[model samples]
Target: MVHVYTGDTMIETTEEHPFWVEEKGWVLAGELNEGDVLRLKSGENVKVTKLERVDLKEPVKVYNFEVQDWHTYYVSDINVLVHNKAARYNTPTPVNPKRVDTNYLKKNGIDPHSLKYDTLGDGADISKYNIYVDKNGELWILKNGSKEFIPTYESIGR
Candidate 1:
């Protein structure tokens, strides 16, 4: 049986289902482990009495970006057994271009300077080019001061 911890009460479930615990937040029923403590919705503590691991019908593969190679480690998302040629360690690390240094950007053929933009006095023409860095650190080229952004890589060579 699976138990769900509500803030003020504990409910026993005959089958696996989504469970919410105050301390651990929302989690799938299959993720629960024996001896795990949870706070009920009423702020009472309860321990998981039983847990069973469920085997997935099909295993899933995950991949991370390779900064040195400037591409994903795996050729396809489904191929998880293939090892990354350039990875130095077993731990997975993903590369985000926005967080990289200017030199790194240049090494990857991205010009950090191209991302700079100046205010062209208010009410600028829609066809004007505006280069700016987004919150995620990716560079974008905005045209006509519109919400649509063209990725830096797409416009870099041209």
Candidate 2:
């Protein structure tokens, strides 16, 4: 039996929540009321003998990663950037901008070296396969044969 603390209130349960177990790397008691037995990882069974309420000085915090400024391209719209005349007609899966490397851009008919950077200035290089948002908030790309701004869903839907 192990003592599982849920906030300031202690309860006994058979197993701690999987999230708490993975995060703390310890067998914490989770969601027990009265008279519960918990089995430990070592196969030893423990019973909840007592429960007590204690005040916590601070609230617990959980952290998770969030991506910012990420761009996604749809299958139908890929033809605008892909250079291969044959593949241009085929529907491709949605792709992240970062996954498009310099070699892939060249195969798709884009001359990375000759493309002009948008507002990002000199630091922005076409070889990196970067997609940019223009002043009008539309997605734009520069390829070997085309010099037009591509309309994104946001612009087209409206």
Candidate 3:
């Protein structure tokens, strides 16, 4: 952990390490957050262990190297894989921002249908097409295998 002096007291923080998430790609150690899913070199998604900052002291040497045909590498002896900030096109990996509508669910018959929940507690997982109210009271429909506020849904039938 890195120690920083903030005027009078020292604060501990995790070092800014690089990570390559398959969904978003090249996220900072701090930006990874507590519950964000981290991507593995083996094409698997896993949760991060910790995101606190740690100092490596003064006169730190940084290395910059690349493995041909790949944008990720191992940083520690324990095989802590890290991803570069940019992909082949000088951009992060792209995620197809798809919006699967309720019609799709009905046509496919994705059951245990929990889309029309009666109460907040009865809502299905956020990854599904479950409606939820935010602290600000805005309604949202989260798509399957997703964790974002998928805006818009046909008004609930009476």
Among these predictions, the greatest lDDT belongs to: 3
Candidate 3 lDDT, 5-32, residue by residue in tens: 3223332334454554435534555555
- Candidate 2 per-residue lDDT, tens place, 70-102, comes to 221111211111111221222222233222345
Number of clashing residue pairs in every model?
A: 8, 4, 11
Least accurate stretch of 10 residues (summed lDDT) in model 3?
A: 115-124
Q: For residues 1-158, write the lDDT of model 1, one tens digit per residue.
A: 44433333444433333333323433345565665664332223456665545344775453333334222111112211111222221222222323335575576576444332211111223246645444454454455545544343222222
Q: Can you rank all candidates by TM-score, best first?
A: 3, 1, 2
| Alpha-carbon deviation at 44 in model 2, angstroms | 2.3
TM-scores for the candidates: 0.24, 0.21, 0.38
Q: Which has the better TM-score: candidate 1, or candidate 2? A: 1
Assess each prediction's global lDDT (C-alpha) against the native: 0.37, 0.30, 0.40
Error of 1 at 56 (Å): 16
Give per-model CA RMSD.
Answer: 17.1, 21.0, 14.3
Better of 2 and 3 by lDDT: 3
List of clashing residue pairs for candidate 2: 1-46, 1-47, 4-29, 83-108
Model 2 stretches astray by more than 4 angstroms: 1-30, 62-158
Which model, 1 or 2, shows the larger lDDT? Answer: 1
- Model 1 Cα shift for residue 19 (angstroms): 1.8
